[model samples]
Target: MLDYAKVIVTGSPISKSNFKLFNMHGRAILPYNSGKYHDRYAIYEQEIAFCARLQNPNIVLSQSLIAVLKVFYKSEKRHPDTNNITKSIFDGIEKSGLIVNDAQITRLIIEEFYDSKNPRFELELFGESRYNMKYEICTKKILDEPKEYGPPSNKKNSYLSKKSTFANTKEAAEDSKIHCSICNKVINAENSVTANNGKMRICKDCIKKLF
Candidate 1:
């Protein structure tokens, strides 16, 4: 259950690296003024046309929004990952005041294509309704499966791993489980404290000294 809306807009999609978040003397910062940054700015500027045209004060009307974008490029050349262009799009919508914050977005889908004459992107936004968080499955088993998650970032899952909040980590760990190859036992993925490099797949209990 959601209130959905879609719009056709034109612009070159910018990749994620265009705007990097790095620590400057221990303070995190996002810089601009590169070529990709310029493209990102132009794309944001182009979206103003649609925002003005729609003139809907509440264009984004939910705490969680799932957007599906069909991005069209000029040619079929080497490109970044399909999901790389989404951050700027969400930032632009937020900049236009349509959305309070890009952090409100919980899901995204991006599809790319090549079209010279009509190079544009169609972005569809969906607002999650209340009670959408309560999920259910026919089976009683609660596996360590995430119903919805964003694109992999840094390969570390802060939400469900040991990095999660102390009080909540155990509960999250309860759902994520893996089987130990040597001991033939199932253990919570987080508690296993995996190195995750090669094909090693033994639980912490199985390891002798962790040397």
Candidate 2:
């Protein structure tokens, strides 16, 4: 089973010799056939290509593993080989002792992909207290007008600051008291700074000096 996971990580075309080892498991493992880029390969190249688009390996494996598991689970009732294939996969996962094992991948798959009730944890990495306002502004600018900044002037650290990124966007109006006209920095509920306009919005503290 763990070996099947390797089908995605190898980043190469599948060969007959290596694929033969798993072929004995039969068609239950057929979805993986799509993983192959070569003739007679079962794994779909599109599946792997989608994973490759992600910059993060954990994200890639997490998606691919989940997709493969779902195909097996859904087909189990219709396919006689399904039960045996699923069992073999679990068994292989246990035997391989891979640090990046299937269980963790399974959790990610269920929580992120399979389980509708599961709460998302991706944003949890940034706790509420640490949620970055300034970074959000910078990211928005990059996404909206990405062409403005070419491949980073400094390739090493390409992250742009909000102030620097949105320095030129015109203010909304003089009377708007609440918002930072330049980047929508809001005035606080408690200590609101009145902009040239009288409208209340986000506070200056929300705006960071970084960008």
Worst 10 residues of 1 by lDDT: 128-137
Cα-based lDDT for every prediction: 0.63, 0.33
C-alpha TM-scores of all predictions: 0.47, 0.18
lDDT of 1 by residue, 53-122 (tens): 3755455555677767898987666445667677656666666666667787787667879888887677
| lDDT for each residue of candidate 2 in 29-116, tens digit (9 for 90 to 100) | 3344454533343342343333333323343222223323332122212222322333333333333332244354332221112222
lDDT of 1 at 187: 74
Query: Model 1, which residues run further than 4 Å from truth?
Result: 19-58, 130-211
Using lDDT as the measure, which candidate wins? 1
lDDT of candidate model 1 versus the reference: 0.63
RMSD of each: 14.5, 20.2
lDDT of 1 at 86: 73
